[model samples]
Target chain A: MKAKVTVRLKSGVLDPQGRAVQHAAESLGLQGIQEIRLGKVFDIELETTDETEIEKILETLATKILANPVMENYEWEIIQS
Target chain B: MKAKVTVRLKSGVLDPQGRAVQHAAESLGLQGIQEIRLGKVFDIELETTDETEIEKILETLATKILANPVMENYEWEIIQS
Candidate 1:
């Protein structure tokens, strides 16, 4: 089984990297870009095929290591191949 | 208009970050995690609603700024709200 996890900063949180990217875009002559927020994606492959077990494992990983709960949020889905 | 861009390392590319994360997970007592790959996501908001123009702008950003063509690949979709 595979899991795709996305972790993003919560609203109102300051993102310096996003700001830097925005500035880079402007310098590159790419117009109309109003805002940008940067996030992370984790592609995980597990040895098990149990959906329930995979969900449980992913939940723990996302909260414990993948995201900063105080400032970030995460969502994940199981991928079928 | 909004654009969600996902950038990932191409297959066969070495990812030290992913390996570090895997080690961290093992230390945390999370089992069954076979492999992991880390990627980046960008949420961009544009001032214009023109689809054609937005695609052109995002294409440039994804190619030149958001991803390294030699090692990484990127995909983006326009979001309407």
Candidate 2:
């Protein structure tokens, strides 16, 4: 099975990287941009194809290591191939 | 208007971060993982709602700022809200 996990900072958390990118865009003459937020995406492959196994693995990945629960939220989905 | 841009490393490029993550997962006793790759996501908001404007902006953002053409591939889509 293949899967994708997205981890993003919570609304109230400070995103200095995003702010820097916004400033860089402005410097390049890009206009009308109000905000930019950044996140991480992980593409994973597994040896097993069982749905139940995938679910358990994804939950553990997202909650335990992929995200900081206090400051970020994470979501995962299996990729159909 | 809002858009999301995903920037991922080209298939042939070495992804040390991904390897590190995989190793970490293994250290945590998670098994059956074959591979892991890392990517970036940008959530952007603009003042203009025009489709043409959004397209132009997204193209610029993905190509010029968010992704390095030589090493990464990027795709973007508008978020309906």
Candidate 3:
């Protein structure tokens, strides 16, 4: 089974990288770009096919290591392949 | 309009960050994780609603700024909200 985890900054959190990207967009003549937020994605290949176990493990991984509890939020999905 | 850009490392690239995360997962007692790859996601808000223009701009952004052509691959989608 394959799992994807997306970790993004929480609203109101300062994102300097996103701000820099926004400025770069403007400089590139792509105007009207209001906001840019940067995030991280993790693609994982699990050795097991048990749906319940996959879900449980992904949940733990997302919370424990993939995201900062105070500043970021994370979501995960199982991709059928 | 909103645009989502997903940038992923090309296959065969060495990802130390992913390896570290894999080790962390093992330490956390979550076994059976065969491989882990890390990537980036950019959530962008644009001031225009023109679909064609959005596509053009996003394509440029993805190639020139959002992704490293030699090591990463990128894909974008326009989101309707």
Candidate 4:
């Protein structure tokens, strides 16, 4: 199975990198870019073919290591490739 | 339109952060984690309702800012929410 996980700052959390990007965007003369939130993505390729198993693995990974539950949020999908 | 952008090291590109994460995973006794790659994701909220326009914007962002064309790869999806 192929999995892609994205971990991001929670809605109210502060993101310094995103802020830097936002500042850069402003400098580039781009307007209407009100906010920017940065996150991390992990792309994994595995041999498993079961969706349920992949989901379980992702759940454990997310809860244990992929995200800081208090300040971050994560979402993932099983890539079919 | 809302967009979620993910940028990562192209295959064969060296990633220090990914190496660090792999080391951390090994320290945690994770098995079968042969490799680890790290990427960035951006969750963007926009007031516009057009997907075509969002795609154009994302293309520009990916090429001009979100990724380093030489060694990085990027993909994005428009989020309905």
Candidate 5:
């Protein structure tokens, strides 16, 4: 199965990199951009086709190996099976 | 409109960070892992609701401001309008 996991900072979390990107974009003269929040995406390819196993593995990987529960929130979905 | 932009290294590009994560995950006793590719996500909020304008802005932002055309590919989608 193929899965995607996305991890992003919580709404109240500080995102300096995102701010920098926003500043840079604004400086580039692109108008109407109010905000830009950055995050991480993990595209995972696995051997298993079982949806249950994929979900369990993605959940564990997202929480334990990828995202920090305190400041970031994570979501994952199976794309191909 | 609210839009999302995802940028990832091209298929042939080297991704050291993703390799490190893969190694770390393997060492953590997690099985069935074949590959992990890392990417970046930008959640952007714009003031305009026009679809054509949003697309034009997003295309410019993704190519010129966010992604490196030599090594990375980017895709964007409108989430809300």
Candidate 6:
């Protein structure tokens, strides 16, 4: 099984880097583009096939690996291909 | 119209930040988590509704703001509510 995770800053967060990207995008002629936020995605190839175990693993991953519990929030979906 | 842009390092690229996060995740007891890659996503609330115009805009945005033309690639989807 494979899992893909996306981690992002909560809405209303101050993301200076994202703001910079937005500015640069606008300068590049991307009209109507307002705000930009940056985030992280993880592509994990796992060894297990159990759904329950994967859920438990993802919980730990989110709390410890995928995000900073204090500042970020994450969502993930498992991919079986 | 709103747009979401996801920017990432091309496959096969080495992302040190991602690796660091992966290690961190593993240490946090995230079993079955192997490799990690960090990326950026942008949420833009646009003023225009024309798809053609948005495409042109995204071209410029990706080339200039969303990614480094030299090392990164980006994909974006428009959202209508």
The C-alpha lDDT values of all candidates are 0.95, 0.93, 0.95, 0.79, 0.93, 0.77
What would the per-residue lDDT of candidate 2 be over residues B50-73, giving only the tens digit for each residue?
989999999998888999999999
Docking class of 1: high
Q: What TM value does chain A in model 2 reach?
A: 0.97
Give the Cα error of residue B55 in candidate 1, in Å.
0.8
User: What TM-score, computed on C-alpha atoms, does each candidate reach?
Assistant: 0.97, 0.98, 0.98, 0.85, 0.97, 0.86
Query: Per-residue CA lDDT of candidate 1, range B1-81, in tens?
Result: 898999999988999999999999999999999999999999999999999999999999999899999999999999996
Model 4 residue A11 distance off true place after TM-score fit, in angstroms: 0.8
Candidate 5 lDDT over A1-81, as tens digits, reads: 899999999999999999999998889898999999999999999989989988988888887889999999999989966
Model 6, runs deviating above 4 Å: none
TM-score, chain B, each candidate:
0.96, 0.96, 0.96, 0.92, 0.96, 0.91
Model 5 root-mean-square deviation: 0.9
Taking the tens digit of each residue's C-alpha lDDT, what string does model 1 give over A1-81? 888999999988999999999999999999889899999999999999999999999999999999999999999999995
Which whole-number lDDT from 0 to 100 does residue B24 have in model 2? 84
lDDT of 4 by residue, A11-47 (tens): 8888999988878867876666667789999876655
- Provide the DockQ value for model 4: 0.55
Better of 1 and 3 by DockQ: 3
Model 6 lDDT per residue over B1-81, tens place: 787878888887899987887788777666676666777777777778998898778777777656886778788898985
- For model 1, what is the alpha-carbon lDDT of residue B59? 94
Cα lDDT tens digits for candidate 3, B1-81: 998999999997999999999999999999999999999999999989999999999998999899999999999999996
Q: Ten consecutive residues with minimal summed lDDT in candidate 1 chain A? A: A52-61
User: Order of candidates by DockQ, top first?
Assistant: 3, 5, 1, 2, 6, 4
CAPRI level of candidate 2: high
Instruction: Please report the candidate that would top TM-score against the real structure.
Output: 3
Candidate 2: deviation at residue B4, Å?
Answer: 0.2
Clashes of each: 0, 0, 0, 1, 0, 0
Candidate 3: stretches off by over 4 Å? none
Instruction: Please write out the lDDT profile of model 6 over residues A3-78, one tens digit for every residue.
Output: 7788888886788888888777766655566666777777776788897888788778777667886778899988
